[model samples]
Target: MSSAKVWTIAETSGRRLKPVSYELPARGRMLADKLGTRLASVVIGDQVDRNDLQELFWRGVDEIYLVTHPELAGFLVENYSNVLIALIKTYRPEIIIAAATTTGRTLMPHVAVRLPAGLTADCTELDIEEETGNLLQTRPAIGGNILATIKTPHHRPQMATVRPKSTKPLPRDESRSGLIHIVKFNPNWIDGRVKKVGMRQIEETGAGIQDTDVVIAGGKGLKKGENFSLLRELAMLLGGVVGASREAVDRGWISYPHQVGLSGKTVTPKLYLAAGISGAIQHLAGMKTAEVIVAVNSDPEAPIFKVADFGIVGDLFTVLPAFISRLKGGKAK
Candidate 1:
């Protein structure tokens, strides 16, 4: 008998799978390794992208369950919850891991209520207690005053929604193979409540939030709102996005859409270039998961460099313009 199975939601955008799907399998490995059981992933959508799924196998998922239905194309809270609740009744996993994202934040609570299980939201870390085989759900509490460690002692499947960029992604190993199970999905079962409403994909001006590989983030070091244009130029030159520190947003230097921190959005872009940013703890809480972090700050002792994979000591005004000019093949460094 399987000791425990892990369930994860696979988010899809216009038939393309989102990157968060890869995160759960890596997280499942962490749980299964401790529990000594299998880590399973469930994909719910109208169709499955076989090519995008190859990465899941490489990341150490034991089983992948695919649920397809016409009404499941977009995010339908009722349909998703019902289908997932049914799966939980059937498999009875010891733990269910979901991303602490917009859709997930809305969906997991409903499922938890239906199953009557304890749910942990925005968990920064997940681990299994070696002796008890229990899931340890850790998250910040009381306005970041305390770090709370919680467990679902009586619940069968302890559910948790983890923040993106909170954990390291496992490297892909192509040699490892896994099992794939296709679950039967009936369109009529969910055709009533779930309707495919108007779908419009909002495109970011300079960067696509979903697929940006590199990001150049700015902080209060900028003197005025006009300074963001420099960050944008550098980002465009590097084929990256322009991110903003919470301070910059609060100061009206940039819009909240570009702000990144605990209160803002979480990003796991490959390379994060932080300029003129002091790197507050709240800001660090968000983008700490970048594969390679490069900090460029005038203050030689800024905290941003602490988590940076690479650090550059300089002034953003002088540094960025020079970098852009060099990239544009105009002037010498």
Candidate 2:
């Protein structure tokens, strides 16, 4: 019934969790489900605890491979590339899905060069063809306007790197179980160019935007950088994070890291509070998955209100202060 085996890359660090690591397995499972085949996942690193691998077993993986070596601890390009290439040469999977995170994006290009496989980056969707069993990788091209579908006819495994938070992680069932194979790895060929100098975790601040239940997102409508304070005040009052549309970042009103759009981070907060944003297509691509969207714009015809569950046709400057005061009063009670 199946023509090819699906493979996914796994990675783990602190409890913080790399956004792309979980995303790749979900994409792998989707392709496997369509192809009616077995899903396998491979992990590389020296100190990789089996906790993340055990979690993946429940997410539809039939076999889990671990290429462990002391030299492969914290994502060195050379060692990871070597291990992944070896696996590709030996196991010969039909489809390989890697997350488009910094590590995945970096290592994927290297692995592709060695394996000579066609690899697509930042893919939004992946599926297997019902008739030919070829992997169909879809990603945005030409500034998110064109959706390109890529296929590797000659390559053994079709490889892709998917953007984080683009797909839902498969439901974890603790009762489900699978096998873990510890592949013996020897650091014979890899030249030790970069030593593990040091490692530090970036502390998350002020209700991490990704983990927030509510987010007050501001756009260029605030008119000036100073006006962001109003949005920040409301966010602080609500105990939420502040997200910004791309236009706001381009206009130098906010940092690019805080920008939310096709080029930036994808967010799916429980309740999204949008203020002063006209909602361009790129911006919508990021937070369209939010559970509830509330748009506060002076213009009733703003595009953001179209996708919002609650639309308030009023100036955010006047609206936010009053809203914050009321929330503060409620808290005092």
lDDT of each: 0.79, 0.77
Winning candidate number (lDDT)? 1
lDDT of 2 by residue, 59-163 (tens): 767787877766666777887887888877777788888876677889888988787888998776687777898988887776556789988888877888876
Candidate 1 residue lDDT tens string, 1-333: 434477666677756677787876788887887777877777888766787667778877777777877667777788888888878887788888987777788888998988899999988788888778889989876545578999999987789988654555579888977777777775544737546668554444422432477888999898788998998888888888889898999998877778788887667778899999899888887677677899999998899989998888988888888778999995665
Clashes per model (N, Cα, C within 3 A): 0, 0
- Cα lDDT for residue 288, model 2? 72
After superposition of all CA atoms, the RMSD between model 2 and the true structure is: 4.1
Clashing pairs for model 2 are: none
TM-score for each of the candidates: 0.80, 0.79
